[model samples]
Target: MRSAFLIAPLLMMLSACAGEPTRMGASTKLVEAEEAILMPPPGSFSVAGITQKRFSNGLQQEIFLSTTSAVPGQNVVQMRLYGTRNDLRYRDDHLRFRTVTEAGIDAEMRGTLPGIPMKRSPYLVQNDYGAFGYAFGRPSPTELCMYAWQQLRTPEGEKPPFAGFGAVQIRVRICETGASERKLLAFMYGYSIIGAVDDMRWNPYGPPGPVSDRLGHSGNPIYPPEMTAGAEPDAARPVAVARPARRAVQPVAEPVPTALPGAERVVVPSPVRASSAAQPAANVAPASSAGGTIVPSPACVGANAATAAACP
Candidate 1:
């Protein structure tokens, strides 16, 4: 009776474990929940204090931080714009590329700043001329360029802009440099969403309802002289333009060297040459011998008793 009771409890414990799901069960549910939510509007927040930086090759980099309405001491958004530099400093060619046309902003964000939950797709964006190729953080059509935005989590121990407001929108614009050069330009904007503000969901640059007009324009809060200096020194030696490498010319094949003495020569038969005049056949029956007159021998006649002794 004691042994039966022990076996029943052990069997019941194993069944309970089989009914429960694994650790990944919770992650799968969260991903499904995130996909169902719609992206928030750009007009929900505002950004200010745009800054700038540049490379030696005249490439520009800018960063715009978000502005809060009532929330204090909270960095709701932080945007960075710069020439394409690998966030992974360990890469062989770090910061050598002039643009980030191929890099993913979401992956870049997660790598640079951890512990922040960001959306993967379906971001909100609007431009003045409607010339933007990509509204989301996806690559553009032509050069694989793109513009993207995502929601950022608010810091802990601080109240959000409003109730249920945990994320702030960050916008990034990467387009052509507009110069004759084929380089790219990047613009990032951070905005803070407050609940108390009117929930007017609209394109910020379309009608200029609430956001600032200088969203895309340059030359605002000009950079200091020292900060604007190029990466290369002013008095550095001029770099020589490198010419393309030329293909090696193949030499013409030369005749084989004259055969050494005692070397066996391959005797190839020469074809018979055609003559201007046709000649009579040499194999025809001859009428006379060249050396003397011809005569029939006894052997030419059928073998008889007299013919057998001598040829005709």
Candidate 2:
């Protein structure tokens, strides 16, 4: 019993190391734990929008978009945290980086996430804090680990091989501005900590147990921010995507060749295929193929006949 008590203090220190300290600590990550936890927008008063998707593992992922959506792919972010002190480690030993040797560590397709220009991808990560690659820039170390951790865990609540996760937690959040409300933000707030099996960058112990997805099912229904009662496109909102404009295919009318050079100006005939039923006289291009036989597209008919480059 005395030995267990002595070890407990060391473990608590380690757990708190990964915990969201609301104050930054010594880590190479761009955003420190303090910065990540107290970063203003997610504070008590403000609630941002949240978006979630379920993965094949039955884990649900809830994402929060910031007030102003930055151009996608342009902004990169990571959240590194440590879990409860109960896992076992030193009193001040913060959650270490996630090691590939650890269980549940896996790779995935970027999905909607933009491609990291192959020229710019740190193709390999050393742990939750650092990566190896030949890119123009690398994300701050701490974030890399946290990002990896966030990517590993989903909202549907994917369980790792471990029966219970030890200290340290990490996550990734993409910010957006145009959201009508903050359901996404609330989701992230609720996601971190709470006896959850957190991912570690590197694990010293051989094989941790499995994560029980069904453990502590208490995170209840989320209350989104107040938006209009109606006309909000209320069913799983669709994102607005921009489209390119269409270009005109035909050129302006020119003069037709005249037999008597200077005598009279002849108007060129307009291109037209199938004319209206009311105007059956419209010049419809005779059907034919481009290379093999003459075949006409609807576009080759009617007033568009003049530009029928496909006609024989």
Candidate 3:
């Protein structure tokens, strides 16, 4: 009778435990989706597919596969976004290219697979949204690869812009065949965040700054320097006066008059040369001085007679 009572109590306890609902961890309770919440601008890339994993704690990871090829073998870009989450545990979580690359290599070597050697160098990437740490390498003669990561959160020692804390992590990996570095990095610079949490405090980007005081002020006009308030149309504007082209003046040759012993030497203008249609003129007439008349030397008769020998 005592053994039967003990067995009955144990059975009852087991049945009660089995009927209770079990709780799952936040990370393990994830819902799979296919919606695209983040993307680059239109025409920049063609989306092949999207995979989204939404966690129970309002965290989401979106992976995008993009086809950038026009022919058989072209560029391919893969982008991942860890949307802003209110959880503080993920605040310091960020991806590094070297660590991820080494992990991949080790996994391949452990599996007896050929490891791809990627020569990585620090690549600085500038973006309007935020700064990103990028690394690039050539895995093969025809394959180019780039990896970039970014973290957006409130700075240390600064209070949250709103009531709650928010953070975002972004990662991108792209490999293209015969693609230039600039072409591969264009996706990083041109991507945009289209999805955001409902709460205002969950903004990865802080509140917009105040408008400048100069804006809309009466004295501070926002027009180009060349554009006046009442400027005339280009066709109606006054035509600039074109000045007449000045002709170059030809130098007139002067004849050297023979020096007389008692009279001052005088310079006579050379006779103008006549065209072929007209008869040639005679030598210049002698110039009369106060003392007497002085005749020029024959050597200094023509326009070409400016030489010292002719003058002497």
Candidate 4:
């Protein structure tokens, strides 16, 4: 009875553009199909399957565990330990001291959780690595303090150039990430998941500035310059690399028809152009009946780009 987690669906996921409502029965069928397909598999471990054993004599132990399934193409391993932090920000000192490590290895931590004594191992990371950590903290009648984190791994041992971000062919034994954010077991449900992209240590020093350059923006005032205080200005900042929009566009190579077929046929097709900078006020998305916020697709910003309020 140590955890209380739930399977969460991607409720707020970006929706495909809607030209019209699906036929009445289609939406209902979609829900039933998802219900049949999205249930959690059996024997899934919530906390990386490892737990620390502490005896009355103060004997400490670590265990390697497994989840119901590890995602395909994603590297994962689950191990449990014993420890706690005063709060959530993942203080370096706290992580360094609490995480169990062999004498010489320095483990990096990405984020913290409440009941589960978990922190991402950022210390073991490669250049351009990434991770996500979430904690289900102290809950109350009307409030559940949920904390989430996403971290990028920094290169630690300095592999070859291609190894910097190339394919490493890792054999991920297990992963506990589920289909929904609300998929929690009634008992032993308190837990977290920290996913690393390349490495575990999050110290990406570039990209934000380059992103600003791409956005043709000076930087948002909300995130003060001091936020990047120690960041080497020459090095890039990583915050600006939010996911770019991806849309499916089809090519129409056929010509258009004209009324005067015998004499001549008029053929014309619209051109595709990159979009310009969006107005600051244009960020809000319309609310769906399910209360989901929908955002616009990413359009390229080029001097000769086309301007469309929304992309379908």
For residues 1-312, write the lDDT of model 2, one tens digit per residue: 999999999999998878444333322223223323323233422323333222222222233434344335422223333343332222344434454332222231143243422122334533332232222211322121112333332222434355323323334434333332233334333433322334563231224458766565665333357754343655886888899989989987898976774554333334343233234333544434333333444555563445444333
lDDT per residue as tens, model 3, 55-81: 323444445455443223223223333
TM-score of each: 0.20, 0.21, 0.47, 0.16
- Give lDDT tens digits, candidate 1, residues 171-258: 4533221221112222322222221112332222223237676666776544446666345446878989999999999999998988
TM-score: model 1 vs. ground truth: 0.20
- C-alpha lDDT of residue 86 in model 3: 37
| Winner on lDDT (1 vs 3) | 3
Model 3 clash pairs are: none
lDDT of each prediction vs. the true structure?
A: 0.34, 0.36, 0.54, 0.30
Cα error, residue 202 of model 3, in Å, equals 1.3
The per-prediction tally of clashing pairs is 9, 68, 0, 38
Q: Candidate 4: lDDT over CA atoms?
A: 0.30
Candidate 1 has an lDDT of: 0.34
> lDDT of model 1 at residue 293?
38
Off by over 4 Å in 3: 1-34, 67-125, 157-164, 223-312
Give the Cα error of residue 196 in candidate 1, in Å. 37
Q: In candidate 2, how many Å is residue 250 off?
A: 94
State the displacement of the C-alpha of residue 59, model 3, in Å, after optimal TM-score superposition.
Answer: 2.7
Backbone clash total, candidate 1:
9
The TM-score measured for candidate 4 stands at 0.16
